[model samples]
Target: MPGRAPAAPRCAALVGPYLSGKTALLESLLFATGAISRKGNAKEGTTVSDSSPEAKARKMSVEMSTASADYLGETWTFIDCPGSVELAQEARNALLVCDVAVVVAEPVVDKALTLGPLFKFLDDNQIPHILFINKMDQAEHTVREILEALQAVSSRPLVLRQVPIRVPGKDGDDVTGYVDLISERAYKYHPGQESDLIKMPEEILPREQEARTAMLEKLADFDDHLMEELLSDAVPPKEEIYQLLSKDLADDLIVPVMLGAAEKDAGVHRLLKALRHDVPGPEVVAKRLGLDGKDASAVIFKTSNQQHSGKLSLARIFGGKIADGATLNGQRIAGVLKMKGHAGEKVPAGNPGEVVALGRLEQAKTGDVLTASGKTPSGYKWPDPLRPLFALAIDVENRNDEVKLTAALAKLCEDDPSLSFGHDPDTHELLLYGQGEVHLNIAFDRLKNRFNLPVKHRRPSISYRETIRGQLKQHARFKRQSGGHGQFADVHVEIWPVQRGTGFEFHDRVVGGSVPRTFIGSVEEGIRDYLVRGPLGFPVVDVAAALFDGQYHSVDSSDMAFKTAARMAMQEAMPKCNPVLLEPIYAVEVAAPNEFTARCHNLITGRRGQILNFGAKDGWPGWDMVEALLPQSELHDMIIELRSLTLGVGNFAYRFDHLQELTGRLADKVVEQRQAAAAH
Candidate 1:
């Protein structure tokens, strides 16, 4: 009987921290596979990935790019995801549909902490991944040291698959090639070409043996037969070792480590071979995602609005073939296009395991699972978008473009679920929320370049409230003689401060018909309207008002008269009530490596935050989670500074905790600014 054929199509995602060369690796992969005639340089703005104008200008990826290639007569799709922490959601969405993730990283020991969150996400989802240590040519430390640093952040064991063969060069030691531990073969790397096989170097024998032994021991931990052979001091067959490695990787029990300099195309072919042989097929992933054996089911991983082509939904077919004009989720597929970066070619149908863009999926969205029966799969779960950490109050430059801006924002938010926009209820300002300053700037760039909407933004206003401290009673009368039914009303109202967070309350203590029963409600309405903008120029809370005494003329005392009198009484009484400002406080939890836990505490304290408690983050070894109560005003730029101090690995989640009194010079300054803004 003939050996079973390889899986037809497989998808892999390239993900890592910023500046780790994922795009470079993508370019090398496409070039080595002959998908492109010549490799394009990222810095030169010629690469297939990162072809967006914004990415070219920044020399970094701001969005995910997909390309398909054929290696060894098997189809493969590679998604090159943005490496910036601000754009991590793009990577997360892409990883969910891929067969494996190529976690590209540098050999720098200090920057190894940056991979902590990515590693945790992958392992938590039980997604199979390979650690491709890129930029090996510029490595400053030994592979062992780099691996040790990386192993600290990863929950799974790091199985070293290749050991670098260093040679003397113009700049100290250089990685000329790598030794394959499983194959027991040596190769010499040639720039822009495949590595050439060579005899095992005599000096590399000891290191190679040690690494290979370690690899076998890790595999033996998952294989009892291999453990028995090791105990007997017997060498396992190469085929048996390869099988065990593949099984362990597919089970997400080990992270196979590979070394390469993607910019130079070294070790590219070997990585491709490993992907072709070891990575599981889409069926395996489908089963893992609870869609096994289902027919005509596909999951959309990305959604985009193109310049002229309209909306495109990129989906990975899980069970059945999707053809042009096929109905999915009650929407007819207008077209099926096989995507290669920004360009695509129309295809008649998309088969299982292939990533294809379905045109005009206006009703479909990212993370939606589509089926031919027009029914959703039960108990299916997709990741919710990340909580927005930064915000900007935005306005359209051209007032005439306000309607256009709303439609454009809808499209943008659909493309990137992490982005959101809405009117702040307290301040009445249209605010845009995103990951950080850079992320929002990119959204602005898209609005201008893609949608032609020029927008202006500023730091969002804090939702500060005013409450009274002192209690007092005042009397006022409204008597207007306009010749016809002149208004006449008299009232004595008492206002008092309530406990914090008690909100507002109104009581009608009028007796003996002093104030008419019908006009009493009008008095409360007028007082409530005045509270909308209090004497301190903020919404008033935690206060109560009562209509204690009042006199009204039967003919002249209408609801309007009593309302006007109530307003006059409040205006004269509030200034003497001693109002104060209250700012919102949030309970924040910051996660970072334990080594930086002290710095995190200082960061919180420096920003007027009260540390609650900190301890080890569950399931995340060598990491700490610090809890604190932080003022909302201090969090506008906190993410930027936190990332700066923690090597871009720290992150935080927060929710409104309580309202605290604001005083001192800071409070004075806020009131001054409010008055100044009101004057304008």
Candidate 2:
């Protein structure tokens, strides 16, 4: 035992939409595996996964939690991921390091569309996954109806592994047990206890046979021998069928669907057994990700801030064994920890395929590859983080807490890469971006509770531009006599709007040293400074200033004098030049399922958007991409409304396109707001 290589540990991630029973399923799995003597309830704040204070208060998971269990002499790690779409980045990173993912979902047909993004990600990455239909006892629809709805969103074939036994009841049809289609065995479920093996029911024999035949037919698509046996009308042995199912699952060719009610601990044992048999090991994933097999390497998929411990880096060992204090990439490992809920136990060494926390890997962040050779393989592709969907302008409540807030924000972004914050130069406010409003609220909570830094947040201000529609020529002089030398400088300048986006040009057309060659640059600088706040209380663009004539005192007229004079000239002329306000326009592309395209169109138009076009998105079947020109002011909170219309799956990408003139009551309101702010 001392010299033998440790049996590789397999890791699985439990992921799904919010309130889909992912945490409950995790509790059931832990209970079934004997990892815990008794199960814990999420509603009671007693579950191992949702152990954080925020999650306990919210009664839902806000982050990824890890646990380990030993079943049948093999060690396995389970990462229970948050179900909120706002927290999807945690699950996305967890999926990359996992051998397989268990996509838990409730049995409502209308909610099937919520899995569209998750399904697409799995298929595109070629990650092996399974569908666990949770809360089956309370399902309003039959298994076939649920499967049909789920299959519509998944690109891979959905193979039903079990057929549920239902009995008519006064409230509804109650699911009592299920028949395994692969082994053709039946069992009756007992709450909080092991299910008893029962004889196959004669009433459901025909249905069981039909479901078993369908499973074989789906598997036969990849296996020629199985197809030939099916064609010859010969029965495949049970062992052969199991082997085919395992191989197909490991290859990510089919999605095997299993049924269970996590609250009752029903069908959980069967699901775990299937995972033990079919889930691929670290070697398979390593080969698929194309990491170097010769060196000791691992991937840091998650980072967290611990109360007692400083920083914990959660990673999957890919190649060789790493012990405590192991030097990797020029940093010494502080400690090796085995995670159990929020608490961790120190471990000496971690082997390949094991999910363990390496303490004080401060330089290591999420999605970084660690290799003993101090280099990464060429073209190694880490999972790409999803684009941010919402943003808020944030600032410290107390001016003294600014530095502490900055450090805390850096740590927060490091813990969750999807969360980002930066200072907006135009608005002069610190802006924080995330997946949605709830995502930002959770971040604020973390800032307050974890870092003890209180902050305020609001919608970001729009960046508007001011330009002229009419031309005017004016002159001004600045003569100041404080004590010594007096300041006397005068200039005549023509102001007019040029073509759009031809921002701020200055012409030195003064003849015979009328304004003096030495002070020309200073005059231009002064004019540029004036553009910072125009007559309309916004930055001026698409205008040119010419210094055609001016007068100056030989002794008093320095650069400062000419600069002051130029500012005076521009300030005097801009208000009479017919200045107009310009609002930012963005080119937006909204992506959603085809059925929601019309709704998406209406949403854009309702926001005063101009439709460019709509069509099928490239490489995405049954999805539409609608392009439009929308005002930047309207784009705020658009994702919230969009998700509400499209079942929480719609998203958009936008960039600043151009500036359009604003008029009518909307323009008047903007001007009034700007004037009031200036007055304040």
Candidate 3:
């Protein structure tokens, strides 16, 4: 890969929905840039972005890939990101370091909704983005209709800057030409090449010229001089129209929509020109972050595990300057890397808006802000990960690998923010939570492939606890006659319920010199330990107990005798207060197509879910958010069924909602498990 990275590199991210041609677009870009000799298609399973075994097998992108290309005297750094919602974190992270977002969308209306969430994110971040209306070569709708569909859903103004030239007497199998609104000139395709050179077309001059005038009018609205010329019925100059675009684009005042065919690599060169000249960079982002451009500061975007490199923190400097081997945020990092998809090289220094990598940064975390020698670190917050949608218990395949499994899984989570890891305290299950079923499976596959950490996954157990709701008192006596001495201890206790979630409480009320002070402490300790598990074998909580009176044999009575007596008293008292099973409830929210909302509602109801409310949310196909209280036990199967019902289009997530009563068959299962665990 020598001489791979050309001197001037423009990094961009290829992002869109699954099967919307993201990988194919990357293949075309690679071939057109001469990085590869031949093009590979996603269906053919030979694209560079899908090079990973898992990706090739599944025919999807599992992570973001970086590649470099030399086009028109510029080295374009392209990152191909997955379109699946599960793997969108990789795409989002890629956007953080890059200056431009070339949003790819199809010509049809149905597939356009998938771009909703991505566009919202870019808009919120004020990222300079362009709309690439791909698949124009076989578009189902006319150019005007496609533009209208995009215009309706777009939050920002999407102005069309390129009009496709339909091939005359052709089956529309190819896009023969295009008109650039700014230049007011036609670009006719050159056979055997990806793009065409600018030349005025002879076949369609008047119509194209008229459309160009209209585009100038749109551009004129952003510029006073152009607006004045338009009012006077004078056509704005071509240079004047382009000059206004640079400012409007940087401000995100307008998003220029252009047509392209990724298969033919027709519009890629135009997109590259836009990136190098139209899009803004780190300076724009740094100013928004309140960072002084002269101050040294950078943000880590992605972290990867290497065989010997330890941890590679891929970052982009936002403000100031950074030199290789320089200290940042109290740790020394390896050299800076100027990234290409399949390759990268060490760099000596980087400035604001420069995409670079730090090798083996010990203390650096993704989204962490690092500053140069004298600069202050500030203003980079990581995107909040999507709520964990699916969870499964994990156990190491080999007992010897248990420690390594934990360490390796932790590293994997550190690399992807959407993942969460912890032990379910009530169930005592080691659970890993992620965005969805496919999300978790991909993560599992990566764990095995990348770090060789093998693990078995199962549905996590429901977390439960035991509590009492009444008051009762009882007496306990432990008397035994052994060889050394007879152990005798008698105790009277009162047990009552506190407010919910108060946990266990123990008190000593031995008054009037009834029980000795030394024995009283032992009684409390014994009761506390016994409260660890109740009659149903759940951690006993929200109950209070007091030792009212006791008698002990001075010669033989000791802590053990008192301990036994106290435990026996608890056994006789807690159940008398009517212990009940309390299960953890999750606040579940389901979003799906409106047609499936009824099915979702019925599904939630069947799962012992309480319908809290329902409403709409953004981006989903007529999305309905069903707010419900669902016990954690039934959630696993509910998710599986919901996905099946919607044909893998339904998505939902839940958090610890509240603890609710568990009085029926599910509670019976808890009791059974408790007995089995006790036997073991």
Candidate 4:
């Protein structure tokens, strides 16, 4: 193994909670590996990651950024993913193709809960990941406490790879270096350079020994020989320890935690060295993804629409090689471009394990697997796009830009599948769905700056229905005289309330031809038209109308006269039927950490929800799923509040269950709003 060649070019994703310094870590990694001449600051808008205008203005990553570097003669590509929860789907898509992920975190116990969803996703997919505790220089809590908090959320066991070595400073103790737990060696940190090998400090020797023993025990759990050696009080050889560490990490049985301060370049080199040795190559990931490793295949993880280049599909080659103008998945490749953030260089070909942009793959979308044969491999799986939790009713300021807005939104949704837009049939609004408000705001910004189409957005309207409680029968006559032929017709219609959810029903119960068969159809058509806008100014449902009898003039009676007569009858009878508003109720299942279960319950109940049941969320440790029936009107901003309560890790899925009668002040307010909008 020692004499073997370096592994193929591998990819790693840097993922963590918001403001956890993933971009900073990416900069440090790039600068340390000589990919960049100088490290860039995210705050100063100089970082290679977060290069987009929206990201630079917000100083946060809104999408994933890809950059490649060379460390110890091995090529590595690192994807810096946005840490905000709203952009988590972007991170998940990038993680699907990577060989490993670096879960960056700050040394704060309270903020550890934010990593629950991210950790669950990595473990659930068996993706190998390392925990890098960034900003160790500003640490307030001990490393053990931080690890403990993280372990509660992670399903995999966390093993400490290094223990920070602190030295006395003018104000307080400073984390000057770290002691390697496996190698039993101490190194002193040097800013902007590799660490220096130093003698183990006697004062921290006991702590270092304890951490080393614990790491060894964790490794022994996966290896019988290592367990035997520990039981016999024999020290395992360094080679054997390294082998177990690599194997266990590749197997995703354990997460090795490393300490670092990316801003100062402290521990950055050490982190890179671990990645060079511990992370598996792309071949292993290819097998895990069920790729045959024989065909010319690539999986698209990200898509971008460039003004000049058109559509660029960022894909990781899984097998064989792809050159410019090659055919893949029945589509001709326009060109191959090597991507470094938003910029790209024309590449003649893309090889296995290298992430590159496939030019002009207009049909290719995120999570699409492309092969030369134009067929998807059997049983291949890709992560589904995350369910949208927030939405807005969007419209163009200039009606002339409607077509451009649609095209721009299509491109945006292609670039980030987490974004979606559609026309609501009931509400008749163009709704843009996404993870949160900030997520959609970034989309709005893209429409204005990238596509030259400015848009306006507002909260979406709820689809409220109107139903009747009482039954009534009304008679009406339509008579008009203007010329030689006069229009005259009479109708008697009975309206009755049916069971909830029965919808609208029309029946012709006429006998003895009291109303002619030709005119009866017209009478029912008028009733339906009237139902579209009920007396309460909403679509009417759960009602039945029957035309039992009517009179028709032999000479002047026509379809229009009968229809007008039926409409007049309904217009007079519906007000006496005691109309009521019917609001849609959804079966909502909220998933959150058990610690916040009580808060979730309060959040639901405070919104006029009825709890149905609560239980443990299957396959999710330390989490609970609370099921409830909540009205549609209460769910507009529920995600915003749920995240605020659960540290942005909570999410809910809901579907329309039934329609319930909505009475009282809330119903009155809804009806008033509907009538006012109708007048406008």
Best candidate, lDDT-wise? 1
The digit string of per-residue lDDT tens for model 3 on 1-680 reads 01222333346788877777777778877777788898876766677777766797788888888776777676566888888877778888888667677888888876665676677778777777788888877787877787676765567778788887776555644567688777666787553364656676666677676666766766777788888998898866666666678678778777888788777777766766666677665567666555555554787778877544577787766656678888888787678876554356787976555567787787777777787553454544556766677788999888898888888888888888888899876667889988778888887887888778778999887668888878998999999998988898999999998887677788878898678988888898888878888888888878888999888788989889999999999988887878899988889888876767899889998888889888786554356788889888888766668867875557787778667668888678879877997899
lDDT of 1: 0.92
lDDT of each: 0.92, 0.90, 0.76, 0.91
Q: lDDT tens string, model 4, 59-154?
A: 999999999888888889999999888998899999999999999999999998898888888888889999999999999989889999989888
Stretches of candidate 4 exceeding 4 Å from the true structure: 1-4
lDDT of 1 by residue, 195-246 (tens): 9999888999999999999999989999999999999999889888888888
lDDT by residue for model 2 over 414-524, one digit each (tens)?
999999989988989898999999899999988988988879998899999989999989898999998999988898888889999999899989999888798899889
Candidate 2 — which residues are off by over 4 angstroms?
A: 1-7
TM-score of each candidate structure, all chains considered together: 0.99, 0.98, 0.87, 0.98
How does residue 644 of candidate 1 score in lDDT? 94
lDDT for 673 in candidate 2 is 94
Backbone clash pairs for candidate 3 read 8-75, 9-75, 66-340, 66-341, 67-340, 67-341
- Candidate 1's error at 311, in angstroms? 0.5
> Residue 554: error of model 2 in Å?
1.4
- Residue 248 in candidate 4, Cα distance off native in Å: 0.8
Between prediction 2 and prediction 4, which has the larger lDDT?
Answer: 4
Candidate 3's displacement at residue 653, Å, is: 6.2
